[model samples]
Every structure is written in structure tokens, then in C-alpha cells.
Target chain A: MSLFIVNILDGLVTGLLLFMLCSGLTLIFSMMGVLNFAHASFYMLGAYFGYQISTYVGFWPGLILAPIIVGFIGAAVERYGLRRVHKFGHVPELIFTFGLALLIEEVVQYFWGKSQMAFEAPGVLKFAAFSIAGNAFPAYKVFMIFIAMGVFLVLLYILTKTRIGMIIQAALSYPETVQNLGHNVPMIFMGVFGVGTAMAAIAGVIAGPVLGTFPGMAVLLGSIVFVTIVIGGLGSLWGALVASLLIGWLQTFAAAYNLRMADLLVAIGLTEPVDVAQSMLSDLWTLTLPQVGPILPYLLMIIVLVIRPNGLLGKRET
Target chain B: MNRFTKSLLGAAFAGAAMVGSFSIAHAEGTIKIAFIDPLSGPFASTGNQGLSHYKFAAEELVNSKGGVLDGQKFEIVAFDNKISAKESLIQLKVAIDQGIRFIAQGNSSGVANAITDAVKKHNRRNPDQQVIFLNYSAVDPALTNDKCNFWHFRFDANADIKMDALTDVMAANEDIKKVYLIGQDYSFGKAVAAAAVKFLKAKRPDVEIVGNELHPIGKVKDFTPYARKIIASGADAMITGNWGSDMVGLGKAVIEAGFDNPIYTYYAASDGITKTFGEAGEGKLKLVMEGQLNPPVSDRAAAYTAKFEKQYPDYDIGQPRIANVIEMLAKAINKAGTATDMAKVAYALEGMEHDSIWGTKVVMRASDHQAIQDVHILAHTAKDVTFDFDNSGYGLRAESTVKMASADSATTCKMKRP
Candidate 1:
């Protein structure tokens, strides 16, 4: 029972962290027709920037300043870079961001070199917040969960209850009509992109110490963030939340248990092969739940895509 | 069409061709060793550091001693394999096409396995274009045991040998009642887990292996859950063979989870990890390596480290075997009386013995071509340390040392000699 409760808490922390990246991503995809392929790179930039800032002035200042710096960079990228390539259509826009992602990784390597940085958590949050069944839970992880939840709440309020949110929602569906109504549609798109990237940066700043601040951090989490939003519904914020939690729980539970496929096969009345190496199903027999934990999210995504087509909350055809 | 103009153009073209041919001939006189490793990926720092050391060793140690085999200078040509086995093979072909006969790589054992097989097949198929592989740091035991090749020579002790020394230290510690084993889910990791189990059972039969887990190599974004599992296992000591960012993440998670027991690792030092661990791992993290750095093994070792640091301030000599590799190669080439005769040089390198910079005698065993040298188990400590690594303000203090002879045993290598 204690293990189950701990797994739930662990899943919540992971799920919320994914939501932080997916929330901004889903918003940008909703607002702008172009999917920002460089979104995760922005997260990497955030971690690097936060690490650099923390070196100069403790972790708190880095937390406040790094995301803001990343926000401006993201805004400039959208305004000057993405805006220039927008007229060339979605393919070119995607290609441009894809190129941007590679460029960002190179720039990061050029500056920081290709190794893990010494980005550690502050002294106050370095200890365990509590222990469950002799297993200590880190204070920083609890802090990450709270911050992610806080961001979700604030984003929810701003997207639904505010005038700018309503304008942004209108612009997503009919940009021409919104522009004709005297709203700055392009400016709204840029703002959404900036804020979305900032959210990713915020995730990076906190996650850097825990996840490891390195050049590959973006690549590690990049595709998974896309999977989270896709399984939720590409443009639906609530859908992203649900999918993120689902994946978080799925992976956590899977990794926490050690179930062998061979045991399941035996239980189902299949005879064990004499020469396992020569058997065609040898790999299947040796497979364990933890070994396939990381791919569970992708498998879930495929199943959801095939059956639902529109995702759990996704409204579009894709 | 003018006779004077045509004659002048022909003269100029003749001069350009002469210069190109001369340069190509000049390059062929030098012993070119292609250093194929990742130079532009997440592991680039390690590869670049190695390249820097190889260049320095070739120039300072080999060439400065009036070159090898009577002025046939050593040259290290860098090739970026991006830490991929397939990419490494492509780079190998490129290196061969460029007339590089000797290849050196030490990053991934997977890449090492690929290059060894490729070199074996290449030598068999194209006898005229044979190449020797000098391995400095890949420590997978199978390279010398089951997959040993005549052309491949390892300058570092393999995993099984390192585990033997590690278990010796573990067996002496009566406080270590329960142990946890965690490693990356790959060949090297599996080897580590297996060796740990084998050696621990033989050495300390009463010790309990509370947990044994293998996490995805570099895909893990969080290690908190894994750390929690380890903590719950009531293990007093943890053993892991994870390196690079994986090591950093696991160490950070272990420290953050407040698991205060000592963690024994193969690569917890060097790179930026020592700096990252800093005070967090003081006395809690221990590493098993080839040489002693904090308390210099000898004055010459200290001076070499100091001079190398002064020359290349950004890098540290993480793999001390680099110097040994170069020195041994030079000795073999000189002994053969020619750099071009790789067959003779290979014969010379077999059963070679030399005094290393680390103040230990290293032997390249004829049976498996695996280097036998003293290995040290060091503990991470911040205070009363003689020297610090990577400017991390922390250093590893020598806890125990394993002799070379005791570390050696008969291998399963059926080497096909020329």
C-alpha cells in the first residue's frame, strides 16, 4: 500500500513536469499554425541560462531571470526569424525551426562543451521533504510538483478568464477576422510563442539540477513532450494534462514493478522452450516491464492515434 | 594559341603538381594514427580531451625524442565518430582511405567491438592494408577474453580485473552488509553487474545483494524513483558502472535523496563530475582507476600533470594510460627499426614491459594483448588532499592499491598471429 502511494506521488511529479512543457507547446500550436520544432531547444537554453545565472547570483535569481531572458530570446526568434519564414508555408516554417534546434544545440556545445554541468540544487532544498516506507522523497521534487501545478493554474486562468485569452482563442480560429476587428493578430501570436517558451524555460530552470544540465537534455525530453500533447489532443490544454498524467502513471507503475513476460506466458499454459536462443520468441520471453517502460508512452500514443484519431481531447482531424 | 603564353602555363602547372606530390610523399614518411572518437556530440569533451592528450604525447614524448624509428615522426589525425558504432566504421574507412594505418579509439566499448571486428576482417581481406588498433580506455573484458584480436591492443585493465580489485576492497569492509547494484542496460553494464555478483559471492558470501537494477542508458530523465528503490532496499553500499551524464544524474539523485552510504563507481571522477559532486560526495563517493592523482604517485607523474595542465589548461589527463600507449608504441616502432613494418611492431608490442609515469611497471600480455598495471581504489575527500581534479576543489585520496600480477589471469583469447 505504501509502495502504491509512493508510486502515485512519483507519477504526479513526473506528470506535472511534462505538463509544464506540453502546456506551452499546445498553446503555441493552437495560436500559430506552425508547430515550433525548436520548442524543446528553448527548454535547453533555459537550463543553460539558468545554470550560468546561478553561477553569478544564487539559484533564486537564476529562477527569476533565466525564464525572462529565454522569453525575450523566444520573442525575438518568433518576431525576426520565424516571421520572415512564415510566408513560405508550414513546411518551410518547420524546416526553419528544425534548423534552429540544431543551431541552438551547437551554440550550447560551443559555449558549455559537451558534458554535464555542476548545476546543483540550493542548500535549503537539498534534503528530503519526507520519507515513505523508508524511501526518502526529495524536497526539490515536491517543489517541482508545486511549481508545475501553480503554472497550470495561472495558465488556466489567463487562457479562459482574461480578455487577452479570449482574443488569442479567437485569433487561433480566425486570424483574418480577428485582425479585421482591430486586434494585433501577429503580435498576439508572438506573445503566445514567447510565453509558451518561457513556460518551457521555467521547466528547464527547475529541472536542470534534477534532470542534469547538458546539451542532450533537450533531445531527451523533446519528443516525449510532443507525445504528451499529442496523446492529450494537440491543441487542447486539458487533454495534454490528462495524457501527461496518464503517461507519468503508466511509466512509473511499469518501472516500479518487475514483471517478466515468461511468467505471463507460463501462466497462460505455454510450454517453455528448451533452447531459448534458437527460439523465435526469445526476446519476448526475456522482456521485462521495466525494460519497456520508456516506450510505453509511444505505444499508448500509437493506440490512441489509431483508435481515437483525434486524441483524448484533441478536436482537430490529426 | 601564342607559343610564349602556352609555354608559361605549362611550366606553372608542372610546378604545382610537383609541390602536391612532394607534400604527399612527405606525409607518407610520418606514422599517422587516426584517433577516431566522438568530437562533436555529448561525449565530445571526453573525446576532445583524449585527442589533446594524444597530440601532446605524440609531439612531446615521441617526436621530441628525435622522432620514432630514426625521424619518422608520429601524427595523430582526429576523426569524429559521434560515439556511434556505425559512424565509427564509416570514419574507419575514411581514415584508411586517407592512408592512416594505425587507429586509436577508447570511448565506447560498442564502438571498440565494431572497430576490432572491422579491423580483423579488413586485415584478412586486404592484407596489404593492415591496421593496428590501440585501445586506451574501453574496459569491456570480452575484448581481451572472447573477442581478442591480434591487431587490437588494450592499454587499460579490463572490467573483470577492475571488479576483482573492487571486490577485494568491498570484502574487507565489514560495515557493508547489504549492497545494491545499478548500471546502464548495455553490454558494459551487464558485465559490471555479472562481475559484481560473481566476485561478491566468492569474496563475501554473507553479504546480501538487496537490489540489482539496470536503467535505460541515457534515456532516464529522472533518477529519484530509482534512488528511492535503492534506499528502500536498505543497502549500505551501492555499486555502479554508469559514466558521463548518466553517472552525474544517478549521483545527484542519490545525494539528493539523502542516501548517505558510500557509492562505488568506475567513473565517478574526471570530466566535470568531480566538480559537480564537490562537497556533496565528499567521502561518500569512491572511484576505481589506474593511477593516483591527488597524492601524486611520483615526482615525474606530478610534473607531467602540471606541465600538461599548463599547456592545455581546459583539459585534464583523465586517462593516464594515454601516455603509456604512446610511449609503448614508440618503443615498439623503434625496436622494429621501422615505423612502416606493422607486423614487426606488433610482435615487439606483444609481451612488452615498461615503467609507466604512474610509478608502476606495465606489461602488455602476449596472450590477450591486455595491459597489466596496478589499479587504485580512491575515495572522494575535500580536506587534506594533495591535488584536485578538473579544478573541482575536491580530490580522490588513495584508499587501496591492487598489484598488477595479482590482477592478471589466463584469458580465453585464441589470437591468430601473423
Candidate 2:
């Protein structure tokens, strides 16, 4: 039971972390009507920048400054780069972001080299916050959970209770209508894009120490973040949150168990096991839960896509 | 156009052609060894360091010793394989087309396996055109076992040999009770885990293997959960064959989790890992390697390391066998009395024995073409160490040395000689 509780806590931490990235991506996708392929790359930039800043000014200063820097870079990208490409339609914008992602990775490699950087958590947060079932929960992980939750609540309040959030939502459904009221739709779009990337960067700053700051860090989380937002629904922030948490829990639960397909096969009335070398089902027979843990998210995504194409909280088909 | 001017132009063109051919001939006269490994991508740092060492060995060791085989100087020509087996084959073909006879690669055992098969097929099909493969670092045991080829020879001890030595130390340590085995989900990782289990069972039957897990190679973003799982299992020690970013990530995660249990690894020291590990790994992390830098073995080895460090400050000779590879290859060529006749050189290399810089006697076992030498288990120490690695201000101090058996004992290789 304690192990189960620990797994849940661990899952919540992972799920909340995913929500941080998915929320920003979903917000950007909803407002722009174009999926930002470079969203994870922005997160990577955040981690790298945070690492660099932390070296000089410590982690706290990096936590505040890295996201601000990333926000400016994102705004510049939207204003200077994406605005010009917008006339060509969504595909071009998507392609531009994709190219931007690759370029960012190359730039990172050029500057940092292709090795893992020593981006460590702050000394105070390095110890275990508590122990359950003989397993000490890292204080840094608990810190991640709290920070992600705090971001979620703050973001929820701003989006629902504030006037800027109302205008953003209004622009999402009817951009021209919002623009007719002299609300400066383009500036709002830039702001949303900037805010979205900044959120991802914030996640990066906190997550980099744990996930590792490397050139491939973006690629590792890129598709999974997309899957989270897609499974939650393309434009639904709630959907992104639900999907991210579900994946986090699912993967954690799977890894924590050691279930085997061979045992299942034997329980299903196969008294004799097939020869592993000669049988075609050898791989299936040898499959274990931990071995297939990473792919469980994709399996869930496939199920969701097949059964409900729009996602759980998604309004339209994605 | 004047007739005299036309004649003058023709003579100049003829003179240039003669000069080009003479230069080409002179270049071809020198022995060429193609260094094929990843020069780009994630593994570039390792491959580049390997290349630098090969270059240094060729220059400082072989060429500086008045060349090998009657003044036929050795040269290293580099080709980036991009750490892909397909790319390595393509580069191998390109190297062959350019009249290169010797190939040196030591990054991935998968790539090494591919090259060996391709070289074997190429030699069988085109007997007149053959290339000898000198493997310096890839340690998948199958290369010298089931996949052994006459065209291929490994200077580094295979995985089984290294694991045998590692488990010997593990068995002797009474403090170790429960152990966990973790590795990258690949051939090399699988080999390490299998060998660890087998040897530990035989050497120390009382040792409990609490957990054995394999994670996706190079894809895992975080290893904290894995470290937590290891901690939960109450393992006293962990053994891993993960290298590169995997090693770094796992080590950092383990350290952060405050898992004080020792980690025994195949590659937890070199590259940027030692520096990144810093004080976290001191006294806790241990590595099994062919050479030790801390005690410097001999005056000659110390002097060589100093010279190499002075020349290339960025690289440490991670694969110390690089020196052995060049020195032994030179000895073989000289003994065979020809640099061009690879068949005679291969014959000369078979069953050859020498005293290596590590101050150990190394034997190139004739049966499997695998080098047999004493392997050392080094402990990561911050102080009371002779030399530090990667400018980390921490070095691996030799804790135990295991004298290796002949290749025949460890290998199931039924080598078919040409």
C-alpha cells in the first residue's frame, strides 16, 4: 500500500511536470491555429539558458530570468519570423517551427558540445523530503510538484478570472471580431505566443536539473508533449492537464510493476511453454512491464485517437 | 596561337602531371590506416578522442621510432562513420576505393560486427584486395566469440573478460550482499548483465540479485525513478554497462538520490563524465578499465602520458590500448618484414606477446584474435591519488587487478582461417 502511495506521488510529480509543457503548447495551438513544433525546443533553450545563468547568479536568479529571456526570444520569433510566414498558411508556419527546432538543437550542440551538462539542483533541495516504504522521496521532486501545481493554479486564474484571459479566449474563437473592438489582436497573439513559450521555459528551468541538459533533451520530450496536448484535446487546456496526468500515472504504474506476458499466457491454459528460440511469439513471451513502460503512453494515445478523435476535453476533431 | 607558346604550355602541363603522379606515388608508399568512427553526433567526443590518440600514437610512437618495416611511415586517415553501421560500411567502401588497407574502428560493437562481416565478405570475394580491422575499444564478447573473423583483431579485452574481472572483486568484497544490475537495452548491455549474473552466481552464490533492469538506450530523459527503484530494492551495489549520456544521467540521478552504494561501471570515468561527476562520484563510483592513470604504472607510461597531455590538452588516452595497438601492429609488420602483405602481418600478430605500457604482459591469443592482459578495478578517489583524469581533480586509484586467462577459455570461437 505504501509502495502504491509512493507510485501515485511519483506519478503526480511526473504528470504535473508534463502538464506544464502541454498547457503552454495547447494555449499556443489554440490561439494561433498552428501547432508549434518548436515548443519543446523552447523548453530546451530554457534549460540551457537556466544552466548558464545558474552558473553565474545561482538557481533562484536563473529561475526568474531564464523564462523572461525565452519570452523575449519567442516574441521576437513571432513578430519577425512567424508573422512574415503567416501569409503562406499553417503548413509553412509549422514547417518554420520544425526548422527552428532543428536549428536550435544545432546551435546548442555548437555551443555546449554533445554531452550531458552538470546542471544540478540547489543544495538545499538536494536531500530527500521524506521517506515512504524505505524509499526516500527527493525534495527536488516534491519541489517540482509544488511549482507545477502553483503554475497550474495561477494560469487557471488568469485565463478564467482576468480581462486579458477573456480577450485571449475571445480572440481564439473570433480574431476579427476581437480586432474590430480595437483590442490590438496582433499584439495579443504575440503576447500569447510569448507567454506560452515562457511557460515552457519555466518548466525547462526546473526540469533541466533532473532531466539533464543535453542537445537531445528537446527530442526526448517533444513528441510526448505533443501526444499529451493531442490526447487532452488540441485546444483544451483542461484536456492537456487530464492527458498529461494520465500518461504520467500510467507510465509510472507500468514501470513500478514487473508483470510478464509469459505468466499471463500460462494462466490462460497454456500448460507448456513454447520454445523461445523456435517460436515466433518468443518476443511476446519474454515481454515485461518495465520493458514496455515507455510505450504505454502511445498505446493510450492510439486508443483515444481511435475511439474519440477529438480527445477527452477537445471540442473539434484534431 | 604561336607554335612555340603552344609547345611551352604542353611542356608545363606534362611537368605538372608528372609531379602529381610522383606525389600520389609517394603518399601511397606510406602505410595508411583508416580510422572509421563517429566524428559527429552524440558520440563524436569519444570518437574524436580516439582519433586524436591514434594520430598521436602513429606520430609519437611509430613514426618517431624511425618508422616500421624499413622506414615505411604510418599515417592515420580519418572517416566519420556517424556511429551508424550503414554509414560505417559506406565509409569502409570509400576507404577501400582509396587504396587504404588497414581499418581501425572502436566505438560500437554493432558497427564493429557489421564491418567485420563486410570485410570478411569483401576478402572472400576479392582476395587480392583485403583490409585488416584493428578494433581498439568495442568490447562486445561476440566479436571475439561467435562472430570472430581472421580479418579482425581486438586490442581491448572483451566484455566477458572485463566482467570476469569485475565480479572477482565483487565476490571478494564481503560488504556487498544484495546487488542490482542495470544497463542500456542493447547487445553490449545485455552481455554485461548476463555475464554479471553468471559470474556472480558462480563466484558468490550467496549474493542476491535484487533487481535487474534495462532501459532504452539514449532515450531515457530521467533516471531518478530507476534510481529510486534501485534504492527501494535495498541493493548494496549496482553494476551498469551504460556509457555516454546514459552513464552521466544515471550517475547524477544516483548521486542526487543519496544512494551511497557503490556503482561499478565499464565507462564512468572518461569523456566529460569524470568532470561532470566531480565530487559526487568520489569514493563511491568505480570503473573497470585496461589502464590506470593514478599510479602511472611505469616511468615510460608517465612520460608518454605527460607528452600526450602537453600536445593535446583536451583529450586523455581513455583507451590506453591505442598505444598497444600501434606498437604491436608495428612489431608485427616489422617481424613480417613487409607493410603491404597484410596476410603475413596477420600471421605474425597471431600468438604474439609483449610487455605493455600498463606494466603488464599482453598476449594476442591466436585462437580468437582477442588480447589477453591483466584488467584493473579502479576506485574513484579525490585525494591520495597519483594522477587525476579529465581535469576533474578526481582520479581512479587501482584497487584490484585480475590476471586474465587465455582467449580459448572465455571464447567459443571456432575461427576459420583463410
Candidate 3:
């Protein structure tokens, strides 16, 4: 059915957006040991920056400038702030990033105020790319899908093929060897941190128009980003891609249907409660697939965590 | 008056100001309405917007006109509830502790319900210090129906009341064959959904109810999937009661996904939503509310909006009822002959009719303490519009109006007067 195809396309868009955030996150985790809890905050910064820039020039200038600005801020945070707190161990780094997230959110609210910004996509991408059974699929969503894929390909090429990328990879496992070879590992880490945050910022720029650009935008995607990376495997880029798309589809399919648990109970010969609304098990009986769609990713993450401690493609334990 | 003087004169000025306030209050007295709502967090914009409206109305209408009950100033003291029921109760206690007899809140119905119960209990336990809840925008019908309170008064039309107005507009449109219902998964959303179903069935029984869905509030980022479901359902039209980012997001998703039918909504034209709906909505998006801004129902309404905008450029008069609330509160205080006697003031507010500046007659229904007024189904488009929202060149134009006479329906509120 056209509905199924529409769901697929929608799921792909959602998956790609998730992958955009997850890719940066997993890359940073692989490069630097600290999982930046302020990752989503960086994304929010990107969206606000994009909106500000777009208002001045256009959406194009905003797309290019916002992510780069956010990148510089990220790099500076790694060098000046995160680096200082790194020696205190993972808990402190976690706490530091957590605090940084809260701080960034407040700073954003202070500057932009607590409301949705009118950040829109370019006029060219405003039209529908195609229509499915009377429903028009936005050109911007298709553009987002391509951007994520392009980022993946470019990141894949650089990480495996480039000299700087090779050195960065070398420093990841054997820092002393890489350092003896005249490569600055700490600077590389900072660069990777910056680059990772820039990727998140890029996602923000792209997703801002569609997902909405508000103070709570970061918080909305915050936990879900963690879920994506964790379910994919800690530091596996491919794993993140797989997990992100999987979640995108999971949520999409979940929301697309009206599958209820009560139906299964009825099919199994269980009698329906006379007063379902008044019963103690009302929530259980009335529970629908779409109602719990948002929680699906978390549920999947828990299952993955319990069953496969490493994740789908993770070589090491999470 | 010169800068950088803090030792003697500045201290004396501070002392004088404190004594001045004390003398002012002691002389003519002050009616303090504790504003307990989300003053912080994501949804703080809605609460802050309401607070701004109340303050501006109090200053411009009541205070500027020589105050109420012979120079008794209306002071709005804010207490952040964080939009939580528990926090609202705590804030209610704090407001009550401050000797504030009047409580004004209208953000979340859950919070309103909690405050209503707490105020009811507070009045029962301590009848001498009775508190009156001046609700401005919580639209759950239960607050005026099943859970109707003697101490509480709702200025905004409840969900069922608004639905009554909305269904009137929907029934007139012959093209609307199917309607898809979507809402945020909460008490208010549930109330709107239930009322919409009930009203539509009663008014137009032939209209097929297609997809009815409730997603977790503020959780879903992309409504494309939901949009797809709506489109696939073959629904010609859609109705939703979603607000805030949810309203903007849902509205944008459905509109962008090519659901070209009319999308009826509540609270879709405020807090940057109007700007987002610009160019995209084109004429599809419509909402049911107390007043239409673009057409400027009257010169007074237009002036009030202009002055309010000059004062707070970042905010909008989303809740037009705030004007009615402050003016009526001042009138009730004067009519009751005392600001401290909340019961007497409540009696005054009950059965009171006021010709609003927006060219509508608002009647505070005595049975349920619910304000019945002329409700407008306004379009968020530029057709026959002047005042644009968020300066987006797209504003509300009245599509239809449900007068106060027809807006009033049978109430199930059992009057339990103190």
C-alpha cells in the first residue's frame, strides 16, 4: 500500500536524521573516551546559529556558517573546558558535560528566549519532491537523507584513506606510538571533538526547519541520541547507522499502526473487561502501539543492553 | 539623582520607597493575585504571556483608570509552578501564606485542577482566609462540569464550550466528509478529543470519524509518520487541540505533507506558531478562540493590542480573555465593596455581563463560574487581514462567530455556594 511506502520514506528520513546525530556522537566516543552529554546542546546551538545566520543572509550561508561556528566552540570547549576536567576521570567528565549541557541551554534561552524560532528551509527545497497516493513528500526531507548519506561516505573515506585520518585512527589505539611519530594526540582529540560537534551542528541546521528550533529541541533529541549510539554499539560508525535507521523504522512503523495489546488478549480467548476505563488494568488493556511509539527506542535500547552488552556491531563491551 | 551615590541619600531613598509602598497599601489597600504557573522551563512562554497580559491589563485598564475600590491597586505576584501539579499545590500554599486571597492561573488544566482542589480544601479548613482561583485559559470541561468549584472561576471557554463553537463552523462546511482527530496525550487533549467526538456526533452525525490518535506530549519530534496515517485515512479534514511546539510541529507536518483540507485547531496562532504557519498554511489552518486579532474586532481592541505590543514586543495577546478577567476582577472588587471578601467578589463576578473591547459580550455564568462569550473560528491567513502575527504577514481573520447566546449550553455544574 501507499501508506506502507510513505511510512518507509518517513522512517528513512527519521533514521537519517538520527544517524546524523549518532555518527558525530560515536565518532567522538571512538576518538575521545568521553561521551559528550552536551552533544544535543551543540545541535541546538547549531539550529539557533543557523536561524540567526539565515535571517541575516539566507539559509545557504546559515548552513555553512552555523556548523563551523559551533565546531569552533566545540573545539574550544574540548581544549579549555573538557580537557581540564578529563584528568578527574569519566564521572567528572560526564558531570562536566552534563553541566555544560544545562549551561548551554540557559545561554540559548537567555539569547533567543524560550520560544520556537521561525527557522525554515530554503525556498528551493520548500516544494514537494514527489507525491505518494495524494500525499506530498517534502524535498527538504529527501535532501536531508542525501546529506546524511554523503556525510557518511565522506567520513568513511577520510577515516580509512586520508593521512590525517590514519594518524587520528593510530592515535585512538596507540597514542604513545602516534605521539612518537610527531602527531599531537591531544590536538587530534580536540579536532575530532570539534569535528564531531560540527556534525551534530550540521544535523541541527538540517533538522531545525523540520523538527523545530526551540530551547527544548536539544532536550527532545538528547536521550534518543544516546539510545541510538548505545543500541548501535559504543564507537562503531556502521553500528550507529544501522541502529539509527532501525529506530527510525521502529518508531515509524510503531506510529503508523494501531496495534493494541488488548487485541492479542482477545484473540487468545481472554474476555474483555466490562468497565475497561474503570479497571486497574485499563492502561494495559487500552495500550496501543502508536501511544508507546516514542518509548520504543528506549525499550529497544534496554533489550539490546540486556541481550548484547556490546551492541549490534560493537567489537568491545559498552 | 546623579549616578554613583550609595551611602546616605540612596539608603534614605530606599527607606522612603519601602515606607511609600507601605503607606500606599495601608491607605487604599492592594488586591494581590498570585500568578502560580510555569514561570520557568519550556512551556514558560505560555505562562509568561498570560502574566504579561494580566499585568498590562491591570496597568492600562484598572490602575490607569484610578484603580479599583478607591485607589486599591491590583498587584500580580508570580510563583513558578514548573507546570507540575505537585509544584502548583506547593505554590498555592506559598501564595496562601502570603495572605493573597485571589489566585490567577491558566496554563495546565492538571495544575488548575490541583490548585482548585487545594484552594477548596484551604477555604474549608480556614474559612476566614478564603482563596478565589481566577482561571484564565485552562479549557478542560471538568473544571466547569464534574469538578466545578465555588471558589474557582474560568474566564476562558472550556473544551466542550469551544467544541460547541467549532462544530458550528464545521457543520456549516458541506465539504468536510471525514475528520481525523489528533491531540497531545494529556487531560486537556483527552478532554478536547472527547468533546470533539461528542459535539460532532450530536451536530453532524453523518461525518465519518476517521483516525483518532494521541501521541505522547512534547515527545515526538517528527509528525510525518502521524501525517502519513492521517493522509492514508482518507480524511478530508482534521481537528486537533495541540498547542505550543506540538501545535506548530503538527500543523507544519500535516500541511507540508500535502493534506490540503482544512485543519481546525486550538492555540495554533500564537507563540511563533503563526509565523511558522505562514505561506504554508495558505488558508487551511483555522482555530477557535475568544477573539480575532487581524480584523481587529473593534478600535479599542486594536488600541489595546497596539499598546500591549509596544510594551512587550516579544509577546502576543494570545489569550484575549485576560482583558475580561482583570476588568471584571476590578469591577467585582468595587461591586463587592471589599477586596478581602472573596465570596462577595465571586458573587459579583457571577451573572456579570460586560461588553468586551473586542466587540463581544462576556457573561460569567453563575451556575458553573464559566465565562460564556462570543467565540470566533479564525483563519491563520492573510485574506482580509490587517494585523499580522509575529510580523509574518499572516494573521487571523474571522471565518465564523458563535455568539454568547448560542455559545451558552446546558451546564451540569451543581452550585454549592458557601
Per-model lDDT: 0.88, 0.87, 0.88
Candidate that beats the other on TM-score, 2 or 3, i.e. the better one: 3
Q: What is the Cα-based TM-score of model 1?
A: 0.90
- Evaluated against the true chain A, what TM-score does chain A of model 3 have? 0.98
TM-score of each: 0.90, 0.93, 0.93
How does candidate 2 score on lDDT?
0.87
Writing each residue's lDDT as its tens digit, candidate 2 over B1-418 gives: 3222444565668778877865654365688899999999889999999999999989988899899867889989899999999999999999999989899999999899999999999988887788899999888888988899898999998888888888988999999999999999987888899999999999999999998888888777667668777877889999999988889888887776668888999998767688778787887899998876768888988888888888877677788899999989999999999877778889898889988987878899998999999899988888876566676677788888887643446567898887
Model 3 pairs in collision: none
In DockQ, how does model 3 score against the reference complex?
Answer: 0.53
Q: Which digits, one per residue and each the tens of the lDDT, describe model 1 over residues B155-237?
A: 98889888888999889999999999999999889899999999999999999999887989998887766777787778999
Best by DockQ: 3
How many backbone overlaps does candidate 1 show?
0
Candidate 2: list runs displaced more than 4 Å: A272-277, B1-29, B125-129, B385-387, B405-410
- B34-117 per-residue lDDT for model 3 (tens digits): 898898887887889889988899899998889987787888888899999999899889888888899999988888889888
Each prediction's DockQ?
A: 0.42, 0.30, 0.53
Number of colliding residue pairs in each model: 0, 1, 0
- Docking class for model 2 is acceptable
How far out, in Å, is residue A186 in model 3?
1.4
